[model samples]
Target: MATEVYRESFERRTKTVRYLRFLEGLADTQVGPIYLGMWGALAFFSYLLCVFITAIGFGEQVGYNPIRFLRELPVLTLYPPPPSAGLRMAPLQEGGYWQLATLFLSLTLVFWTIRIWTRAVANGLRPMVPIAFSAALFLYAAIYIIHPIWVNSWNEAPPHGLRGILLWTNHFSVKYGNFYYNPFHMVSIFGLLGSTLILAMHGATILATLAYGAHREIDEIEKSDEGTHRAQLLWRWVMGFNATAYSIHQWALGFATLTAVAGAIGVLLSGPVEPDWFQWACRADIVSGLQKACVP
Candidate 1:
């Protein structure tokens, strides 16, 4: 009985040591439970705060009925209270909840970006994920924070709703003499549409070759597999060039990143830098015969 007790105690110690070693290895990876847990908690709290604020806005605007809230969701807008509200806590209808929700959402984004960067570096991978994500984050900041500061009015920021966003976009374009003439905006459109096209091509190529036992098309491409080879040749014939399995992803990432980068630039330049995109285009000689429309 003494020997059996000693064996059980030894086994327990061994298991504990193994668990500690596992945790140590995870920590070394820079994406351990602690990092993930903090990120998850921040994200969850941000989401909940936003939901709570939206619920309150909906209840105040369209009664407490869930069905009514759902029906009116498309038209409901949560306008941020005036700057007089300041950083101090105010009533829910006076933008206190919006401020809290925005604060937590910003924190969530910062932590999420850090998590992506640290995890990528620890794994000896390129910083593409974080870089692309940061560009998107910049666009969000440009709309909600940077541009608002530049214009000296928080009201410049769009309200939190579907129709509200559309209304904001319309107001922006009308006030600034049309956004289509903005070169950065044009580039963003190209980037977004080009990324979609690239994704569809890549997905279709993989699916098309799946029937020929080319499920692992990326690996098979190097082995000169018939299905992958044919797919590549088909694209080369159609487009005069083709991306390799590895290069295709890089191409997609480039376009996707360009979309946000261009959008952020355009947003930053809208009011302070140029004020009117149509006039800028006319001055740059990109458009003609619309001088009358370009009048300020």
Candidate 2:
């Protein structure tokens, strides 16, 4: 009994020491920055949430029922504050909440991105996650920041309601000519669809092979395990090639990253670069017989 007690005590001490050492290592690696960034992001996000809730309340006060607003035309929306409002807080009806929400949102994204980068670096992982996330951030900035700045009006940015954003998108497409003809928009759509297809294919393939005892590790599958072997053969027969476990992940990452990157590029190019995608398409001979309609 004494021996067993000693052994337990020693084991406990060893674990405690290891935990302390791990913490020390984390400190040495500057985990504080990660925590700091996360806290900053959380704070901003919380504030933004409050702003949204308040905006909803204001929407209700404006005689528009929150629940039924979607059913009505001219849908309830939190519009951007006028430029004349400056940085001062205005009444909720004057768009003060939206301006504050936008500011908090921008800060939240920045801090969250920093946290992602720091955490990935501390864990010795590739920066692919943060890099892919940056593309999404770029798209947001293009729509809310860059585009507004280019047009010299914050009102150019979308409002803070579902139908509001939909209306903004329709207005944007109409004012800038149909976005369907934009090459970047086409690429983005292709990437988005391709990512969805790849996700479905990979998930279905795995599930289909599971019944065949294909739950082994990738290395085991590569060694001609019966179930995984059949899977490989099935894919080879259907597509003339098969993706290994490693390669399938690469494929997923490429498609997902391309979707965001292409979307950002499309948003950035929409007004400043192309101005009118439909008109450009007509000039490029990509479409004909609609020049009169594409005059805008």
- The prediction achieving the highest TM-score against the true structure is 1
User: Mind giving the per-residue lDDT tens digits that candidate 1 earns over 135-195?
Assistant: 8899889887788778777667777888988998898787877899989999999999999
Whole-model lDDT values for every prediction: 0.78, 0.73
Instruction: Write down the TM-score of every candidate.
Output: 0.80, 0.74
* Candidate 1 total steric clashes: 0
| Model 1 TM-score, 2 decimals | 0.80
Error of 1 at 114 (Å): 3.0
Error of model 2, residue 31, in angstroms:
22
Runs of candidate 2 exceeding 4 Å displacement: 1-75, 82-92, 288-296
Which pairs of residues collide in model 1? Answer: none
lDDT of 1: 0.78
Q: For model 2, give the 10-residue run with minimal summed lDDT.
A: 25-34
Looking at candidate 2, what is the lDDT of residue 274? 85
